[model samples]
Target: MNSNRPGVLILSHCGFSFLEDLKEQLQRRQLRCFVLTSLPLAEHVPARLEQIQVWADRLYTADSHQLKLEDVNNALQTLHKSGEQVTCCISVWEGYRHLMAAANAALGTYDIDAQQALALRNKLNVRNQLADAGLSQARAHALTAPVLQTLQAQSARYFIKPIHGIASYAAFPLREDTTWKALETLRLASVEDTVYASAFNDGLQFMAEDYIAGQEFSFETLLIDGQAHVVAIHEKYEVTETADTVLEDSCTTPPASLDQAQIAAGLQWLEKVLTCMALRWGCYHIEARFTGQHWDLIEINPRVGGSLISHSVEAVTHGHSMLSLWLDLLLASQDDHAPRDALAQQLNAFQWQADGISAQSVATFFRVYFAQPGTLSSVALNELPLAPTVKHILLKAGDVIPAHAREVFLGQLLWAFDRSRQAEELERLAHLSATALDIRYEPGTP
Candidate 1:
């Protein structure tokens, strides 16, 4: 990093080694980092901001949390007034992109303006961008009940999601009239004063889009200086009721076997969306569904995916880290990660084995399956000894989680394989993971 360049400001929440891993990467490139604190919610107190600063190698102490737009302005004003030069503000927080983007604007940290930030945070604005760009996507609209009723009557399947939710929270899949009515109740419940309300209410609107059928996969990459650089693509096994109380016992990411042609098509679809969005620099996540050879846009987040998704994939697939690549791009971009790569459509998202259960059933199922293999995979439980493939096995006896494959499916069992035997080996481990962690919707269900 050039000594004259301003310190990099990382907007972080959810304490973990992500920051530390990033710090190590930056150190290798000699870039200095500063952690600026922001509240994730009413309770998103920046507890370890100072600790982050120490790990970051530079320090900026703005200890208060931002809730309203005014709060964001105040924080930005403070940063802008401070003599230090600001380089960039990266939103690595799980569900707090709006807050992160707002603070970035207040300080004039990047070129994006307040209006543009609103456009990114609001679902309604994104809908217009797709329409204006003439991008191929499911029909989407910010709706009134009458309009929703009419569309629901025509469409075979539809998706209902909050304009500004994190973790795919409150995402509803409308397949039947019953499901559609359940969504109506859910929509009204958002207006309720109860805790069961939809997370996005204030400026957040709900989006109903024609449900695009096919396998679902995710792509996470950094958009440095506007271009979308591919980072890690995850073969999504499931998208279930974990976030949406609207349904239950439904969600999974299946195996993603691919041909070079389909993979290229997917990448092209992503490239087109980014070009039209007028996005300049940041982390972005795109979800698209494929039917036969055609692909329909599901959604695109102008930030990183939640649940440490990119990081976990990298951990299991290759020795290289996705977050590490993102930090490198943010500070000192690699010259050759350019678009004209010799490699044809990269094999990014591939599910090797049985789909994962939600995070809820991870603990107990892992114990029994590892103890006895037939329950999960055909292999005998006693055949193999524990090895490095097990990253963090959350399955333990007596944990309170049930086996129902709802929101928190079998706890995430992520593992990596050596290239020479990567494909076959990882599949076996995934099968073992599923076997060890059985599913039970009700308590003691599995």
Candidate 2:
């Protein structure tokens, strides 16, 4: 491999399903792709390891599941010494953002700094930043005995969540009877006994924030030079709150509940929030709530939204997934001003339409199915007169669904329909949720 050739470094903790598409796109631009993953190859499934081997020009694996900063720095140093000049670094995994940022800093690439990445990962820090700027109506307190006592005294409803969390783990409504001991027990069980333990980079800390009531939506946005460009807006039509976590099962894009005017207003408010937080560049999956009067912050994810969000966005944008666009943005950031400006213009003028369909007439919806903790026997979707456009199965027969797993997804389905059929389609989705998906555990198993 020529050291002079441009290269992109990807840091991953566990995800690899997107490698094929990402590799094809990168190869088109004549760039070499390198991957550094915390997941040891010996423990990885053969199918996924094959995906990585097919994608990376070079693959480096850490000794453990959790990556250390020193190990990441050493890998970059080795690449540089070998004449592989990595110009950009990226990761879709939230747990590795700081590592990505650090790598970019060392390589003189474009990305937020390590400090900013750390700040963004902490829910408490984000809440305080929004509160200081008056962008949030909710007040958050660290989960301590004193803070719990204070919340009790206020006699107001609040939500408890991990300060550094993924997949809505350890998130629940804070009740009057909720105690510090109960929270600790849940945190230990959820964090220590699960596969995502490494994601909680910031130790076992939690927070309780004032709960805001309204319709929940997420803005899939891109920022260039401090300006926000919304690529898609998804309305969470169905959210289930469990005893320990929150599961968002279904979503529809172009927000079936909000009109064009309201969507425009949301975009404006989102720009302000991003500006206040000083989040200047990259893809952002920002979750927020809309009261009848105004919008409040839920949380801001500095990566592509998970599940089928990237796929749905790609469908609406006529072939641009959040990951693809983010890659383009990173490559463009290293180029001269002319190319960067051109990309900025294109992102700003994007519309949600595909195959010549008008933006208002096209809607993409997806539903996720989850399984309980047990030895899985089988999983399948009953034959439907009309099937979804895409189907993804995450588990197979004989796989054990861990009791402490944050969100054990069985499969996911996505469909595209005309906006006029939104009502009818949603009803069908509800029916599928109740009966279409069949997940069975082993006999006599809970």
Candidate 3:
């Protein structure tokens, strides 16, 4: 019942590894947090529950995957009746962006509309939206049997994936010369993969887009009052996709490899897309490719980048985390009539933090993937750096790993190293991963 403390409603804490860090940040700001999740409270670890009980004002569970708009409004009304106020509604997960928008709109808070949120999430919809804006995008077609036949007849090369996909799930390149048998195999695999893929898409509808060729990069940004501010640009290092999925092997923030002009061009492209999409308030994780001529739109999500990227951002920016900046923007939106210029100034302030770390240090997130399929008996890594670094082992001994599926990774190693030795350190890190790391499999487990 503390009226002075602003309240935030977060949806579905499931499958998010960094919820504790997020909760700690909110706690430090003295904000009252309420989590509405589909997971039962009993399923959580007692230690986790203790921490949640300490910080979260309430954790409500429902039967649905994402709480419906009416459900969220009812909860907000009940909280108001109890002398609590929910100032904002948002979710850090990619799957619930639109659902969060619906709740925010219902609460008369700052948010993107449901329609726009959908466009941001659905890749095909985004391509269409950018095309309408005269923005260049890969030519795409829906992946139907007839459409595949038609494309085959025309002999075109395209990238095929589900309408709503995540982490490169069900994403593959379709060759014009690909046989019908190969297409059928891909379709069957996609249907199976979609069953366990992230939030949206049932693996039914897919699209084939003209493959945009170039080196890929991720631009982390924030849109406030219709202005897009670039936080950091990451150079995504991906291994060749001998398999169906192409996942990021690692990524370096501030992309030391890219020159100033290239960085500006990437940010400019982001602003163009944001302008066309009319994003008013939120964080954006945009992936694109630079063809040495122009930047081609890959996909844009209206949420913070996943996989603990915020930790690396904090390391690079001293202490400013993208989540904190985003939360600050939401808090600023509490003003019923804040001028756009004032909001623009706030954007500038955030940009200063992001730009301040450009010259001091560089951060990298290295993902470890096992090429062989079997039950992992044990894994060992070489001596890790004594400096600030975070390591996560996703799989343990005796866990079965599927063949050629990039979704399941052995672990991730993140570190913030000296800027001057970035190239040397990266090469050393790669050598250590290949030579210093050892993996053993259970006998006859594959």
Candidate 4:
């Protein structure tokens, strides 16, 4: 560890609570930490910053980054001019990576700059590069139909997804009709199409490409020395939050569900992507679907998987912590890790419990996050409200909350046991959580 430098900077948007576990973990290792809370409201700003600063060595407000470009630059310039050096600037939050990159560039710190960072966040740009560079991938098109005339020129089942999205946010199966609707509604033909749909379309930018339908699993990796070394193959169990109406009823994952061949194929596929992306000095959470014999590319996230996948990895492996390694790399002048294969040394069975939510009004959900459970006696308040069927609820009353679900993965109940017992255990637990929450969705959206 570089005792000369403090530690890394954890940049967050809206709320900084997400960095809590990482800060605590680092302090356990006897390291200093800094926190900057970005709040949406002005009046509440300094108080929140000070509250964290009491525990943290320093603080920063998000206006320090978002309001003005120089706000971020000046901070960096001031830090450097004051004779300070950063080990690595990190953002487990995907959206804030741009701010991290921007700050690092301003400080001339050791990190990936604003341009190279784009390859990770911008999908269309990545798609074009993959196609032109001949990397292993399922093809992608940003056009709607008459516009896809050029895409139809290339034959494949083609998957469609937004250029900027996270947590499998809005990715889904698409056909010719989807392409036509999107292009026609946006008048895609009238304008020259670009890699990012955000500029030209009112809705979201989507890519239509060959849908690689097969056994699907997640791949977690950290690149070192321009190589995409493979990590654990996560057994992903999820429900489509889009098509489903009964929000809390969806979501289920069994145990040890991936085949050896599927694992091998996913590893092979990411190698090509890492190389093409020239990814080095960071972590990536990639989703790939394997057909009968071929591995097709889904989307790649150059960050850790949310829902505490990193925590689960450490629980199972009992080895290197993903966040620690990520921070080490970000702070490293030398690019190195225990080696991808060695890093994920544990295969012990574990599953993430990212089930479902009530999908009600933000205000309604607010009760679940902030109000405390009233001892089943005092006044009255549904402590675990929000359609109680959601089990193993993490939010306690009086606990401050983040604005969006993306920052926190709300799981009903997660059962961890032997793989043999996991299925039955999860079933019983899921049933219990379902009954407890009893989430009821009335006919229409309120």
Candidate 5:
């Protein structure tokens, strides 16, 4: 609340579980951190809520589940009335990007423009925009009742997903036999009254796009004033399709599947794709498929990749996490051109080496597990043949799993390996981890 200190406003949905780590990093740089969230206080775990209250300089909770521009503006007005100066606004949540943009606009700060933020939320809009520019190979259409019949008659397989969705909710493959009734039923059962409902802020419109078949990968990129820098590339080792959504189970860095020549070509293609989309600044988790000769667009997420992606990137990139670098970028945006240019040059020169471990010799891999919809009785790791560097248990006993059929994480395990043995070690460890881990549910619950 000191008027002389520069403040940062963070817009969040649900809850930011990693506030302590973020606060510590910001505090070291003499930045005051304030949180404005749309998650109702009653929904928070008592212990987690206490940690949030203790870490943030100021906390504002909205009565509603979804944050809007009016809510952000009101909070800004209150801060101004108190003689506080908020220099920048940021959010890692994909659904609240537009609200973050709005807040920055009101404060005369730096962020993606409001129109571009809104355009990124719609899947069909993104596909059409990129396809028109020859950046994407997929063709997409809005899923309406009249168009359902036409889509069914087509021979090409389609991927059905919400226009504005997160956590892979309500995403599945559409076969020739797929029916509109089944899609509607799944939409209601998965989205309505579920924890993921707030993510569909732009309504429940769905789209069907031609399914691009190839090996899946994600590029973690950082943009500095319209220039793209590739931080790391992750190859999805295992991708499982559930009844309603696709689950990315395991990932490895430096993509074991692609050669250096392909990697270089993919980076060139990605630069063009980002430029065509008009994404000038911010962190992007761009997902795509590589069909041997070329790459196809899957989706572009305007935030850090979720579920230990930041951790893996930090391990390989000299302890520089995406969140930390992103904060540095935002803070630098407020400075004059000389300082900004210097920081950008430093970021651009980042190399993948840390603590004597070269990126060419080291590899990081992580595996995520999901549980079925039911009442959780227990989740435990009985034994570990290969010790992981980091392990996180997300759900505990007596936790009731929602029936939304989304990716309900049970736990995650991350490990570091020598690049020479990465493939063999990953397979062996994955198999062992699966057998040693135990997850049980309450009887007669589904």
Candidate 6:
């Protein structure tokens, strides 16, 4: 590896807090980071200036919301002019995965299925791809006016959501009988309603897909040359489901409920789907549901798992960084000596062991959501027998809580618990939600 060559180029769109941790970790390994972010430099730049100054060797900003190919190329050329080289580029955000792939392809360091990148963002397209590959069991229909009208008059149950979405936002289960009523009730919003900033102008398109009934799990994986390596399996916990919406409450690693056979089956399905999609290199956070007899694909994202899953992975695995592994993959893509063989050899070295993660430790992350819309008066957590590792409070006492049709959380808590205390912790947390965690609100017009 050339000393003057750049170590990694990070394409960041939003200021996710975890990116700071990732950058620091990568830099600790003597890897220099260059950042190309599409976020407006005026408004969002000041907040992250400390991080940018500390971790980045060079920083490039795009004037617009979308990262243009020309802009990336220009930045690469500028780096070359300054006697710097970008060996690998990476992003953990879903919206920027395509951009990262495009940049990688342009650099000729590694190849990603660009078409698959586009297809992965749209849920309907993913469903179609899965069905075509004989990798999915569910049927999905686009939510056109006619289709909604027909579904309104039928006896089918389905789930409907934006074609491109994150954090289960705007996703709801639809019943055939109440489909028309639900449509009338659903507030029509555009791309502007999205939580993260994006360049997608494709106004909200919804898909009505068969809602598979079973236990849901996420397979955190790394793909090298389209080969899927399972890092960890996560058990998804949902806030008590209402008729219309489902929101995530917690995610635990090691999927305690899944048997070894079921875990093997889930990995097999993951590999097949990754191969079918031709995702050559990157991190994947794939969600799936398993019935007793069959498995259904929920969604497959060509990025690292969101929320605190990455943190939980490290906590459970005793400091093994999944993001570091992904960065190494990118760096290996630019190797002069045995590129493919180097990647393969590195993959083997970091291969995820079935027993690598400790069984005695269980890592869990919980999302805190407010039920009432008003000015938040106060929030207090109940004392637990075991203290949490990380506590991120996203809202303060005086923050205004806007009314949302679907449940939106205020903050989150990350905990690494002893296996023996898992059940007790869950129960205590639930009880605390009802009694100890006081979320007082000053009523206002919603």
Clashes of 3: 0
lDDT of 5 by residue, 1-446 (tens): 46589788888775563555577767888888888877644556565556678878777877676788888998889888877889888888787888888887788767788778878878888988888888888889999877878988877788989888888888888866668887778667655653567677645678999888999999888888888777778999889987678999999987878876777777878888888888888778999999887888888988788888877877666577777777777777764777568767766555322221124456788889887878989988777767787788889999887667478888988888777898798778768766556889999876
- Stretches > 4 Å off in candidate 2: 1-5, 15-17, 41-51, 351-361
| Every model's TM-score | 0.66, 0.92, 0.85, 0.68, 0.92, 0.84
Per-residue lDDT over 324-402 for candidate 6, one digit per residue giving the tens place of the 0 to 100 score: 6566667767646476566566555434444333242554545455455678877766676545676656567887655
lDDT of 2 by residue, 1-446 (tens): 66467788877775363666667667877899887877643445556656688758888877777777887888888888888978788888788888888887787667788888878889988888898888888988888988888888886889999898888988888887878888878767755643578777746688999898889999888878786777888999889888878899899987877766677677777878988888888888999998877889999998889988988887777778788888888887764777678887787556432221224446788998888888989888888766887788888999887776267778998888776887888788767655667888898777
Q: Please give the TM-score that candidate 6 achieves against the real structure.
A: 0.84
Cα-based lDDT for every prediction: 0.49, 0.79, 0.68, 0.49, 0.78, 0.67
Q: Which has the higher lDDT value, candidate number 1 or candidate number 5?
A: 5
Is 4 or 5 the stronger prediction by lDDT?
5
Off by over 4 Å in 4: 1-5, 41-50, 64-69, 81-85, 102-113, 131-137, 148-158, 175-203, 244-255, 335-413, 419-446
The digit string of per-residue lDDT tens for model 4 on 85-129 reads 555466776666666777666544545556676557677777677
RMSD of each: 8.8, 3.1, 3.8, 9.3, 3.0, 3.9
After the best TM-score superposition of candidate 5, give how far the Cα of residue 329 lies from its true spot, in angstroms: 1.0
lDDT of 5 at 115: 79
Predicted model with the maximum lDDT:
2
Q: After superposition, how far is residue 362 of candidate 6 from its true place, in Å?
A: 5.1
lDDT of each residue in 103-154, candidate 3, tens digit only? 8787776778877887777788778778777787566777777888787677
Clashes of 5: 0
Candidate 2, clashing residue pairs? none
Instruction: Report residue 149 deviation for candidate 3 (angstroms).
Output: 2.6
